[model samples]
Target: MSKKVILITGASSGMGKETAKALIQEGHTVYTVARRIDHMQDLKNMGGYPIQMDVTNENDIQNVVDTIIKHESKIDVLWNNAGYGLYGAVEDIPVDEARKQFEVNLFGLATITQKVVPYMRQAKSGTIINTSSMGGKMYTPMGAWYHASKHAVEGFSDCLRLELQEFNIKVVVLEPGVIATEFGEVMLKNISQFSSKGAYSSLTNQLVTATKKMYDKGQGSKPTVISKTVSKIVNETKPKTRYRVGLWAKPMVWMRIYLGDKLFDKIIMSQLS
Candidate 1:
């Protein structure tokens, strides 16, 4: 396989970090970006280029793009993976916080894609992989904002794939189920605010408790699983438009499609309960 120049966002931890490492091991020039530069120092030590980037900052993204263009001359792959989970009840999460979630998960991702597209167009060949979630297809309680953002990613990626197909630019969506990460801790923190004494307090506490327990028990797949799937997508000559990774991703997607909405909702509710 030809060594490709790849730029991966959110590479400070979890799947992004693992993917960067795997790509580098395969001899690809991996440029990893994230807010915490220190978290990516290990990646740099491993021969992956680390760039301090916050997707919400347009200038930061532009700088990274410009740097890559200047040094690599062209980017062969773009992993739009910078995102977070802002889990809370819709009624409890402030509208501003909800918008911020979209800003980071959806708008920020789109912004980086926009900056990279012209370069890909110039090269006339490139692969764009987006990190969506299983929640993108199947909804879960207390994650309304996060799910909405991911759903937007689902739609955005689909449209982008269609639009960029004629340009020989492949757009792929990576949908992952729960993985052992700091994501659950963040979600639990958000839940505390929503679960504060109120009409929905009981349900909120139940949901938070269940989520925390699942994560604490380490019931989710490892980040390496998703990272391997990403490596295949990056290296394959012909990659699937969507690669659903992790333990529950495929089963949940199947249930969402075949079981219909009512049943799916019941299953999801039961999971939380």
Candidate 2:
């Protein structure tokens, strides 16, 4: 396989960092970015370029793209992976907070994609890998805003794939379920702060306990699972438009599909009970 110049966001840790390391080891020129640049010094030490970037900031996104193009002359792949999970009851989460969720998880990804697409289109060949979640396809209690943002990503990526087909830019969505990352800590933190003493207090407590139990028991798939998926998909000439990997991703999606709304709702709520 030819060594491709790649740009991946949210690369300070977790799946993004792992994938960046794997790609660099394979001899690809990789530019990794996140809001926390210090978290990525190890990646820089491994021959990957690390940049401090906030996806919500347009100037930061533009600068990262410009820097990559200046050095590599072209970008062969863009992995839009910079996102966080916000969990709380809809009524408990302020409108501004909800908007911020969309800004990071949906709009930010889109803005970065917009910046990179022109370069890919000019070259007539490139890949855009978007990191979504099984939550995009399924839903859980007290997670309305988070799921809404991911759902938007699913729709946005689908439309983008159709639009970019003529340009030969492949758009792929990754739906990972229960990866063992700081995702749980971040999510629990947000939920506890927002709903720990509201109408949703009981639900919040149950969610926190259940989430902790799941993670403590090591139910989450390792981050390497997703990193390997990134490696495999980039090598494919005609990769699938969407990949549902990691533990429970496929089954949860299947359950949501085959079961009616009432049954699926019961199943999901039972987990919190």
User: Clash totals for all models, in order?
Assistant: 0, 0
The total number of steric clashes, by the backbone 3 Å criterion, in model 1 comes to 0
Clashes counted in candidate 2 amount to 0
Clashing pairs in 1: none
- Predicted candidate 1 versus true structure: per-residue lDDT over 1-95, tens digit per residue: 89999999999988899889999999999999999999998998999999999899999999999999999999999999988888767787799
Compared with the true structure, all predictions reach lDDT values of 0.90, 0.94
Best by lDDT: 2
User: How many angstroms is residue 207 displaced in model 1 relative to the true structure, after the best TM-score fit?
Assistant: 1.2
- RMSD, every candidate, angstroms: 1.1, 0.6
Instruction: List, residue by residue over 61-131, the lDDT tens digit for candidate 2.
Output: 99999999998899999999988999988988899999999999999999999999999999999999999
